[model samples]
Target: MPPASHDGDRDDDDGGSFIDMESFYASSGVSFVMVLLTIASVLYINPYWRRVWFYYVRITITSCYYFVVDHLPVPVKYKVLELRV
Candidate 1:
C-alpha cells in the first residue's frame, strides 16, 4: 500500500522558501545598519548639539514658569518665587 500524503509537509521537488525572503532580509539588514550608523555619528561627531539642545530646554522651562506665574496674584507669585529660590 502507498503512504498517505500530508498537507502541511513540503514536497521534495519544491524550490526553497529562502529565495522568496532573500530581498526582504537584505533590505531590512541594510536599513538596520544605516539607522545604527546615523545614531553613532550623531553621538560621536559635533556633540555640541547636545549643549545647544540643553540651552533650548532651559529656555522652554523658564518660559513655561513665567507663563504660569504671570497669571497668579502678586502675593502668590512672590511666594512661589520665594519657594523656587
Candidate 2:
C-alpha cells in the first residue's frame, strides 16, 4: 500500500502518526495454545500427548488443536483459557 501522505518522507497515517489497534482475542488465542501445551507437556503425569523426552508431532498437534479451539466462543469450556477480561 502507498504511504498515507507525501510531506517529507511518507507518513504511515493520513492523519499524522501511526494508528495502533489492540488485538486481544487473537493474542489470547496464541497464549492459550502455548500455555496449554506447556502445561500438558511439563505438568501432567500422563499427558494426553506426551510420552517422550523430546518435542515432536504430538506437541505440534496438541498445541494447534488447543490454539484453534481456544478461539471458539464456547463459553467457559474454552473461555477459561482466556488471559484477559
- Compared with the true structure, what per-residue lDDT tens digits does model 2 show for residues 1-85? 9779747776555454353334556788899999999877574666544555336767888999999988867867645574786
lDDT of each: 0.77, 0.68
Give per-residue CA lDDT, model 1, range 1-85, as digits (tens): 9899766675553354645566788999999999999866785776798677668889999999999888766775456443554
Best model number under lDDT? 1
Q: Per-residue error at 46 for model 1, in Å?
A: 3.5
Query: What's model 1's lDDT at 25?
Result: 85
Q: Which candidate comes out best when scored by TM-score?
A: 1
